[model samples]
Structures are given as structure tokens and as C-alpha cells.
Target chain A: MINLPWPSGLLAQAAPAEVDYIANSWLGIASYLIAAALFILSLKWLSHPRTARRGVRAGEIGMTIAVIGTLLIYRAVSYKWIFIGMVVGSLIGAPMAVWMPMTAVPQRTALSHAFGALAAALVGTAHYYTLYGDAAIDRFTMAILAVEVLLGSLTFTGSLVAFGKLQELVPSSIKGLPNQNAINFSILGAALVVGIWLTASPMQHWLFPILIILGLAFGLCLVIPIGGADMPTVISLLNSYAGLSASLMGFVLDNYLLIIAGALDGSSGLILSIVMCKAMNRSFTNVLFGRMEPSAGGTSDDIYAGKVKSATPEDVAMLLEGAQRVIFVPGYGLAVAQAQHTVRELATELERNGCTIEYAIHPVAGRMPGHMNVLLAEADVPYDQLKEMDEINPTFAQCDVAIVIGANDVVNPLARTDPNSPIAGMPILNVDQARNVVVIKRSLSPGFAGIPNPLFAADNCLMLFGDGKKALIELVAAMKEG
Target chain B: MHNLEPKLFTFLLATFLGLEVIRRVSPLLHTPLMSLTNAISAISVVAAIQVMSEGHTTFNHVLCTLGVIAAMTNIIGGFWITDRMLKMFRREKPRRD
Candidate 1:
């Protein structure tokens, strides 16, 4: 029989006897190189919203190739458990992706960090015992494993705590234990010492579990003292930890793909942490240690004291009806009350009346970085209509009306005027600069930072008291009627 | 197996590359960026596979099982969520022409 590059015969014939390739093999190396290129391309494509979907596509393709390539490298391992892992994971993961509401994205992000970290830590633990059985572990590999497990375990628990806080399953307030910072630092210090000791003497089996326990302990210690308002920075910092652990896993396995991907994740998290810190105008230390300094700025009653003017939905409708330029400042309240879509309806109604509408998104506004953008974007608001703090701050002056929806600290003029206020140095939306300011909130209750917003009491400001979504729906109906 | 020179070099170079490549991602896409990167780091699935290849022991089986499942979850969820999020961001013209 003449050789025809025999199609079906080749696939079925060679499938059982084909040469297995490791990452160092020519084909495996090529696959890794291609995967790495795709990853870089994935991140690069995210430079604009227009190209972001393409980024996701590139990432999915890259991941598939990496997984297939890794699977082929070894056949001695039992594939049964690995197969079940993927299947069970998909069963859980798919629904989470399909059914989760967009507003739940923060908790979703926190959960991702936890799972990633937990996976890395588990792998490090397995590597330790596998080598220890054969008594062939080396100092360098052991050292890298120690770092990997420490980072992974700590981040795993820390991220879980963050998820709990975001989900409100755990109390979000700081427990304010005495010498809290000192205790946290010492726990971390002890973990580092144990990790270093285990590295030098790999035979000390007792030290290994202790190292892991200390790491797990420090994770809770690190996140427990931070309040809900500080979650953005805390989450970002945990992201960096998760990625760093993965990078150390790379070093242990000598897998260049793991190193590249983990490093990318680490740097991405690092940059986000910087952005979040700058947005809040607080350092990592201040946010983590204690940022709840009493604001000598006094109480909400002192600021409001009958100076506030209350308005109804019809009154807000009339104000919107007369406004030519309107801006919306949305905060965590908008997310809590699920008012995003309704607010968009209100904005659309006003836009039809020839009012130029924009939404000023404070970077740390909702709960995490880009929180408001995700909520507003999910409502089908055009990307161009969503403006960042820096871009929209100056434009608030030209705005005929600034509508504050479930937003407080971001629009509080006290940040700029009162030096003694806790939020004084943080940059705020210049909502007070507008000709008329309307706030939609449930009550005069203080925001997360527990400070009164002076803008609510300003001469040009009026409070529309009600639930955010209900207020928006009523105003939308009123706008349609008029 | 003892030489660590090449691995260290690869890690350093890759990290610097990461710092450079990720600097340009739009802040607007940060939420998606996090999801995608978290998924990417789940490449630690490769590490789990390595661990599973070791001689079968109860401890090894237990560790690798947990490792694979956790990593797989991140791998699946991260990519799924990132794509879902990106799909939400588009320029919708609410303009009445």
C-alpha cells in the first residue's frame, strides 16, 4: 500500500504510540512560545474597550494550548483525578459565570483570588511530600517552595476573608484589637523565620506544617484589621500576593510558562494597587494599619442642622426637565440598592430632552477598582458617557445639574474645604461646582468613612430622600409624564 | 535538576516583560483585567499535574486532587467571567436620531 499520509489510519494508529513530548521537547517548546505570545497579545489588546473582547479570546486560546501541552508531557500520572477536577470545576464555574449578576463582580473577583491562591498552595504542599518521600529535596527548590506556600496560603485565606466582607457574610468593621499592627507584623515575621528555617533544614518535618500554619494565620491577621472602606487596597494587595505565589511555583517547577503568566498577574495587581492608593490618596501602610482617625470635622447633625433642603421625585423631575447639562455621581449605595439600570433609564429620559448626560465614576466608588464602571456599563450605558474622576471633575462646573445617586464622599465638598476631615486629601468629584446639586439617598446617614458631606447642606443642593432605585424609577416616570 | 540559573533568569526576564506589557491596560477594563490575569495564573494547574506525576501516595493523591480542582476552578471561572464582563462594555448610542 502506498503511503498517503494515511488520514484516519494515522490519527487512530499513532494515537497510542506517538512520542510523548515534554516542555523541553521541540514541539512542546513551540507550544509554550506560542502560548506566551498569545498572553502578551491578550494584555495588549485590552488597551481599549473596543479591543477588550479580543483579549479574552486570545487568553482562552492560550490557556487551552497550555493545558493540552502540559497534559501531553507526561502519561505516567493518573489522568482520572485530573479529569474529574476539570469536570467538577466546570460544573461549578460555568454557572458562576452564567448566573452571577454584574453587581456581584467584586465578590467574584475576591473568590477568584482565593481559588488561585489555594491551588498554588496545595501544589506546593504536594511537591514537598513527594520529594520528601524520596529524600531528594535540595535547598534551593525547598526555599522556593517555602515562599510559594507562604504566599499562596496567606493569600488564600486573606482573599476568602475579603470575599466574606464583600458578601457581608463576615463583619466588615475593623475589630480594633490592641497593638493590632504589632501582632500582624510579628505573625508575619514568625512565618518568615519558619520558612527560612525549613529551607535550610528540609529534614525537619515538624517545621514544615508550622510554616504553613503560620502563613495561614498571618493571612487572617493581615485582613482582619482593615475596614470595608479599605477593601479596594486590601483586595489589590491580595491580588499581588496570589500572583507572587504563582511565580514562585514557576521557579519550583522550572516551567517558563508559569513564570511568565504569574509575573504578568503580579505586575497587573501591583499597578492596580498603586492606582487605588493614589485615588484614595492613602499609602498602603495607612490604609492597612489604621485610616479611621477621628475627623475633627464634627458630626452629621452639626453639618446638616436644618441647612439641608429636601425635595421629592416630582421636584427632581422638574429640575432634570430644566437642566441642559447633567452629571451623575454614583457610589456604593447605587450598587447596594441595585439602582444602576433604573438610573440609566432616568439618564436616557433626560438625554431625550437634549440634556448632555455623564456619569462621574470615582475610582474606588462602588467597592473595588472600576466598580461603578462595571455596574453602569452592565446597564448598557455607552462607554463614552462614563467618565473618570479626573476627566469629569473640571466639567462639573459646566454642568447645569449634578445628580448624586447613592454617592456621598466622592461629592462631599468637605474634602476640599475642611482640612481636619478624614477624607480631606482624597480627590473628589467636583459635584458642588454645578449650578444645582440633587442628592438621592435614603437618609442623612453618614457614608462608609462616617463623615458628613458639606455639599448636602450647600445652598444649591437639595436632597431627594428615598431608596435609590425607587427614586430613580419615580423620577423616570415623572420625567416621562412632564 | 540542581542548577537554578536558567529558571531564575527566566523568572526575572518574564517579570520585567510583565511590568512593561501590563502598563498599558485601560483602567476602564481593570475588573476584566483582574479576572483574565487570575485565570492566567491558574497556569499553576501545570504545577498540580507535576505533583500528580509523583509516585502515588495517599498524601500526594490528596494534595494533587485539591490542587487540580482549585486551579481548574480559577481557570474556568476567570476566563468565563472576563469574557462575560467584556461583552457588557460597548458603545451603545442612546441618541434619538
Candidate 2:
């Protein structure tokens, strides 16, 4: 029996002898290219609700290819660990994707970002441990590794906190305690100083873990002061952090592919954050330190406690009868009620009754950018029939009936009349302009922005209080009966 | 060219393709996403500085400088643009109302 060297034995058993590097590499490259194409296609498809499912599928396929490519190149001593990790990840991730309510999407996204950050941090730490004593590892490599570990760990912890806030595990809106920002800045400053010192003095390896701890503290300080309303931006920012960490790890590993992918992810995340900020008409600085006064007012119970003029589904259906045109304004309420499909069904019925139906989307209607559009599209609402704020605001006056589904601040008349209102200047859908307005809500509650809506008090506006989906379904039934 | 380098190149190309898909499928526009992505591109700045400071060739130094500048544009300019756009949303009351 021929005795093989231990290194050879490891390599031989790790990969099949029949495997062709040329073919495998080509295949890997091809798979990666295909994945990239799919990702792009998915993004394009996602822009419209009609094609979003296809886009999601495309993205999934691309990710699969990426995973396959990584697996192909990876030479692991033990296969069990990798398989176990994959299984565990899928088990945890699949159910969460399916079971999580649409209302908790922002929290889900934040958690996903935390997972990404943790993965990057783990990779950096593992890489550092593996190559610690190698003479080939230079000061630059060590510095990059330190930076990656620090940023990744911070992103992981910070994202978890953001997730907690979004999930309401902690209070969603907390004002910074006196000197909170100061303390946060000081902690961050100290962490940066320690990080610089550790990198400068390679001899003091003990300082590395200390730097990581400081980074974790900095991340906590960074996210804790941010309000819940700004969670989308925070999630995007954390995503960027995770990407930067991945890029830094790429540098440490001298992997060009990782560098490119990381850079792309980081840039995209940053852009998304900016877009979200723009949608809310807030600067990044404002989001970070601006303590946006919680939309000043009483809670939902206080606002809805008054005599709300409730309309039954039959009444709403009768009101819709003989209406020349109907416009539907959807808000986060619609999303929370998961009433998109029902709204689409209602719209079809209304259209069949010789009433022109259109959807009015406010710029900042839901929690995140494009929230309303995404929900509407999910229900297979036609893109052309959906009108942006600028377009539908004019049309609202011509509509015979305006149906508001779970929308509040965006349709409130106070934005135009009340100077003291927090959301005064922000553009809103002019649902109040319609001849008759019917608001479908669970209660006469304030929206996420926490301001009283005068639209509810308007003489023409009739409040239809109930679950948006159930109300819409009943309305559809009533319309059929009429 | 080495076989490994070509494979690496292909991998990069594939990643770009994936990004394009994400850009398309996303409800947001690619231009904005790309611009925002520039912020993450700042990692290139650190990478460039570290690589150049390591006393590499003049070509490497030039490359690093370019990378740093591009990354800075993405970070600073991107943030500035976002700030300006958001400022427009500041609530101003209608005088007559």
C-alpha cells in the first residue's frame, strides 16, 4: 500500500479526483454570472408589483448559485459542520420568512442584517486566528482584519438592538437620557482610539479582543438613541456596515470576489438608507441625532375614544353605488391588515359596476419606502392604475367616492391647514378632495406619526371601522347584492 | 493570463450581474441605489490607503488614490444629496389655511 503525505491525503479526500479544475472553475464562473443576471432581473422585476414574485425567484436562484460556487471551492476537513449549519440556517430562516407578519418586515430585515454582520465578524475572527503567527501576514493585513472584526461585531450587536426596537421588545420610541449622545460619542471615540492603538502596536495581541468589546459597546450606543420610526434607515445603515466588514475581510483574505461583492452590497445599502431618508424628508444627520419629536399627541386609544361615525359594509356598498369614480388610498394599515388581495377584489367589483377605480399612493404612506406600492402589487394591482401623490392629488377632486384603507396621516387634511402638525409640509394624497370620502379603519386612530387626522371629521367622510380585509370583503359582498 | 485570474474575473463579472438583478427587482431605482452604494464603497478608501502605505509600486499608489477619491464622492456627495432632498419635506404651513 502506498502511503500518501498527510497534506495530500487531506486534499485528496476533500475533493474528488475526477473533478476538473478547468471545467469546475468555468462552471463556478458561469454559475456566478448567471446568479448576477438573476439578481439584476429580480431587482427590475421587483420595481413593479406584478413582477416582484419573479424577481424574488431570480434573486433566490442567484443566491443558490453563489452558495454552490463557495461550496465548490471550500476544502473543509469536516463536511458535517457545513451541512449542519446550512440545515440550521434554513430551519430558522424559512419559518421566519413564512410566519412573520407583514407588519414585522422591518424587524425581520434588521434581524437579517444582524445575521449578515455576525457572519462577517465570525469570518474575520476565524481568519485572524488561522493566520495569526504566519510570517507572511503583515501589519496592513492585521490592521484590515482588526477593522473588519470591529465593524462586523458592532454591526451585529447594533442590528440586534434595532431589531429589538422594531419588534417592540424594547420601547419603540425612547428619548436619549440626558447626556446619552455625549456618552455614546465618548464610547465611540475611545473605541476608535483603542482600535488605532491596537493596529499600531501589533506586539500587543491581547488588545484585539478589548477593541472588539469597545466596538460592541459603540454599536449599542449608536443604535439605542434612534427612534423606531427611523428603523428602516437604521436597518439599511447596518446592512452597509455588514458589507464594509465583508469588504475588509476580503482584503485580509486577498479575495477579489469578496471585495467586489462586499463593495456592491455596501453601496446599495447606503443608497437605500439615503432614499428612505429622502422619502421622509430627513437628512442622515437628522436621523442620527435629530430626535424627531414623536408625532406629538395622545395614543391611538385617546384619538379613537371620541364618537366615531361608523358605517357598515352594506352602507359603504350603497355609497359606492351610482358613484362615477372610486379611488382607493392604502396605508400601513392595509399592510398590517394584510388586505391587499381583498382591496384588489373590491376594486375589480367596483370597476365592473361602471366606476373607474384607481389607487392613490402617498410618498411616505407605510413604514419603509415603497411600502404601499409593494403591498398593492402583491395583490396584483395593475401598475398603471396606481397613482402617485402628485398624479392622484388632482384626480381626487373628480372622484365620486374615495375609499381609504388603513391610511391616516397621508390622507389627513391637517397637513394642509394645521401649522403645528408634525407632518404638515409633507406631501399627502388629497383624499379629502373627493366628493365623498369613506375611511376603512379598525378605529379612528392616529398613524405611526402620531397626529390627529382632521379628514375623519370632514362632513363627507364616513368612517367604516373594522378589519380592512373583512370590511373590504363585506363591501364586495354588498356590492354584489346591490 | 493565469487560469486562476480568469476564474476570478468571471466571478467578479457574475457578482456584477447579480447586483444588476437586485437593482432591477428592487422597488427603488438603480441610480439611487448605486449612489448610496458609494457609501459602502468607502471601504475602498481604507483598502487603498493601507495598500499604498505598504510601499507598493507607483501604479498601485495611483490606483489607491483614485479609489479613495471615488469612495469619498460616494460617501460625502451621497449624504449631501439625501440631506437636500429630505429638507424639502420639512413641513411648511399654508399661510391662508
Candidate 3:
């Protein structure tokens, strides 16, 4: 809006001077303030499940108000393209919401960030060009604009890579030429240097395009080396970047509500990223700089070297017969194998046999934080049955059977005993402490941490070698037969 | 930098408020929280609309149109996905087929 070159002659013919003044008057400020308050209340309400729906509703209302307020104050001369855009957007958005499986939610989130950041980048680019004609380049404004575009451009491509990784369009592991980390850092460093130079000299017209290219390339590089295991942190970090860019865009436009709202978004995303890093027991640097360190204590070779006990579905069903309490631990493998429904069915059959069932969710389990919760919730698992790491750890000791469905490092006892292991100090569900442990997996393979799990070799642990979904179906059938 | 005092103040205040508010959200809602934030950040759609409606040149129109399309997708998709996710969080047992 700030960048659109308004023709002075046409503006005089469109509306009287008095009408223009009232449009920007106290009414507009009051509406924006109210919208801001609603946004704050919406976030507060979302904090608890009891009021989450209401919170979502509040946010919707706030967005509607913000859109409407902008319309009232800045009356557009034409509405043709706006209507077309809204219609097309709804057409795409509605079906996507109705049809996308919950398993694809992480990819959906990354795509959303990509779109949002693209918008910000376009706005920043438009602003630079429009203001350049007037030569209204000032040091402070130039610096802010540089940051806005830099963050926006990087987030746009960075989020796309994240989407590709989550959707598996690209390999989830480090791809491309070797020395990939070095190349990525160099792109980032070059972007920063170009961005700084542009900030100092806004009129260096040729430099702007270079800055944009560098930024987009840097985003691609920044995310390419990161594997899917660190997806939560990457997604959260990208969200923070998008939010900060929007906030800086607010400054360039001098819109107070945009500033407040964008900053709120930026900070929340930053906090989430930090929390996600801590949950994995890794610092931001380690996650970014260290390609996942292979666990020192165990490897796939070591897994086969140790004695691993294998069991059949019938054996697991028989073990469950007299079990009073069963704990289900899920990991990324369960998601990859699309086994949530089958696992739920197995739990239900077990419950009918007078067994109690609960889910033990590691804080960093699955690809994203709370990913397992979404999977289970989609399969209609009761909310009460899913317990957080702290809430469920103690219960594992009393658990008659802990069925680890395709989980690995999170249950690795090396975290507790081996100080040299990559995942040392990270809290794991004490599934190994259960009287009996059954792990359903295809083979003796390392997980995201690239670690061999000692839990598989434990005295009570029985490995059921098969795909998660097929194995769960077999277990359910055996349970029904028994 | 000194001239940006008001904007900086707003930024700091909002950052503090955001940290406080987000901490209260249960981990179960982290996904929804993220989607909601993505939607709000697309508030720049307001700016995009202004640009399109006030079109001066064909080039400007094209740029703004792209902005409108991208931001609208984010806003619409973000909200719809969030609502769907929140619906799944109901405490009542989902009806089994």
C-alpha cells in the first residue's frame, strides 16, 4: 500500500478532500487497536485446550477486522483483481483443508510459510522501487528495508526446501556435492555481506537484485544440509524469519498494528525454536552446524553384533493376555509406515481384553514437535491416553508391557549411561524399565540420531521384525484370535 | 537509528508480550499455534490489496497481483488448516466407524 504510486490528478477526481481525511481519522486507529487486542486475547486463549476453539475463532474474527479496517481506510479504486484473488485462494484453501491427510500437516505448514514470506518479499521489493523514484532514501529506512527483504527472501526458499523435505520430493538427508556445509555457510556469508552493503548504499540499484538472488540462494543452502530429523527446529526458525521480515515491513510502511502483530509472531516463533532445540538436547549451533552426529555407542553393525531376541505377533499377543497396563511409544517410523490407525485398533482390542493402554510421547519424537499427537488425534485416539514425557516416564516402571512401535534413539539407554553418545542428557521414555518391552521395527537400523538402540538387546526387550503397519495388523489379528 | 525509536519500542513490547503469551500454550497446540502465526504474518495482504487497487503501471499491477495471490493463499490456507487441526483436539471420544 505504501509503495503504490498514487496519481495526484486522478485522486482529486475520485473523492472529495473531506472524505479522504475522515478515512484516515480516529476511526481507523480505533479499529486497528481493537484488532490488536483481539489478537493478544486469541493467543492467550489458545494456551489451553478448554478454550482453543474459541481462541481460533477469536483469531479469525481479528483477521476479518484487520482486513475490513484496511479496506475502509484505504479505499481501493478497483476491486476486480481482489475478488478474483480471494475466489482463487478460497478454492485452493478449502479443498486442501478438507483433503490433506494429517500426516502431511508439517509440509502444509512449511508451504504456508513459503507463501507468506513470498508476499513480504514482493512488498519489500515494490517499496524499494516505488520510493526510489522519489529518492526518499534515508539511512534508517534503508537499513530496515534491507533486513525486511533479506529475511523475506531467505524464508521464501528456505521454507520451500523444508516443504520438499517433509513431502519427500527431495531426499530428507544431506544431498548435493560434498563439503555441503561449507558451501551453505559461504552463501549465507555472501548474502549478509551484500545485504549490509545495500543498507549502506540504497541507491546502488544494481546491488538490490544481487541481494535478492543471494538471499534466495542462501535460504536454499541453509536448509539443504539439514535432515528431516531436525525439521521442527528448522520450521520454527523459518517461521521466526518470516515474522521478523513482516515486522520490518511494518516499520518501512509505518503501520503500528503491523509492527505489534508481526513482532508478536516473530518472538513466539523464536521461543518455539529455542524450546524445540532444548527438547532435543542440542543447541541451535549444533543443529545447524553439526550434521547429525552418529551415535558412538552403537551402530547398525553393532546392533547385529549383539544378541537380539525376535518374536512373532502371536508371541506379543500372548504376552498381552495378562498385562494390566500397556504403554505405546511411537516415533517417526510409525508415521512413515502410516500405522496410526492400525496401532489404534490394536490398542482398542487390547483394552477390550481388560488391559489399560496409554501412549508415552517423547518431547522430540516424530519429525516435528507434537507430531505424534497430531497423528494419534487424527486416528481418533482419546486425548487423555496421550501423555507427555514427564507425565508418562514414571508410569513406564509400572507398565506391564511397553510396545515401542518403530522407535529407536528415544528409548536408547545410552543416553542415560553413555556420556560420549550424541544424544547424551536428552530425556527418553523409560520404556526399557518396563517389565517387558516389544519393539516393532523392520530391522536393526539406526534412527535419526544414527544410533543403535541398546534397548533392543535388553533382557526383556523382544524385537518384532516387520513394517510398522503390517506388524500392528498382525498383532491385532493375533489378539482377536487369542 | 534514533529516529526509529517508536517502532523499536513497539517491537520490544510485542516481543515481550509474545514470549509471555506463547509460553502458556500447551505443547499439544504447538502445531496450531504455528499455523495461526503464519496467517497473521500474512497481514501484508492488506498492503498487497492497496497496491493492486491503486495500480499505476502494468508492471506494478503484476507485482502486486503476485503479492495478493501469495498472501491470500497463506492467509486462507493457514486459517483453514488451523481450524481443521483444532477440531481434532476435542476432548470427547471421536465416533468410530
Question: Interface RMSD values for the candidates, listed in order?
Answer: 4.3, 14.2, 2.3
- Determine the TM-score of chain B of model 3: 0.82
Q: Please give, for every candidate in the order listed, the TM-score of chain B alone compared with the true chain B.
A: 0.90, 0.52, 0.82
Per-model TM-score (chain A alone):
0.94, 0.80, 0.93
Tens digits of per-residue lDDT for model 3 on A1-482? 33221233235545565656454534566677788888888889988878887877877788788777776666643466666767776676667667888888889888888988998888788777766756767767888888888889999999999999999998875555578778877887887787778778878878888888988998998888888778999999999999888888888876767788788789878988987888788988888767665655645566556578999999999999989999999988999899999988998898887788899888677777678888898888877888888898987889999999878888988889889988898878889999999999998877887777888888999999999999999899998899
Query: Judged by DockQ cut-offs, is candidate 1 incorrect, acceptable, medium or high?
Result: medium
Q: What lDDT would each prediction earn against the true structure? A: 0.83, 0.62, 0.81
Candidate 1 root-mean-square deviation in Å = 5.4
**Candidate 2 stretches greater than 4 Å from native:** A1-78, A98-103, A135-137, A294-315, A378-384, A413-421, A442-445, A466-482, B1-97
Candidate 2 per-residue C-alpha lDDT over A1-482 given as tens digits, one digit per residue, 9 for 90 to 100: 11111232345554655346434544655665575465455445545444544544564556556556644543222234344444555555555545555456556556656666666665555444434443244566667777888898798789889988877787866666778778878887887787777667765667777877888888887888887557667777787787777666655655444566575676556666776676566788777766655555544455445545678889888999889899998887787788888998988788777788888876556655555654565566656676767777887889999999888867877667766667666667888889999999887656766677777877788898889888888989999999
User: In terms of TM-score, which candidate is stronger, 1 or 2?
Assistant: 1
Q: 1 or 2: which has the higher DockQ?
A: 1
Instruction: List runs of model 1 lying over 4 Å from the truth.
Output: A1-24, B1-3, B94-96
Write one digit per residue (lDDT tens) for candidate 1, span A1-482: 01112233345445434433322344555667788889888888987899888988998899888877667664567799889888887887788788889888889889989999999999998888878888978888888899999999899899998899899998877565888888888999999899889889987878888988998988988887777777888888888889889888877776778888888889889888988988887898888777477687678788889899999889988888889999999989999999999988988798788888898888888778788888888998888988878898888889999989888877777778888888888898888999999999999988877888888999999999999999889889999998
Minimum summed lDDT over a 10-residue window in model 2 chain A is located at A1-10
Clashes of each: 0, 21, 0
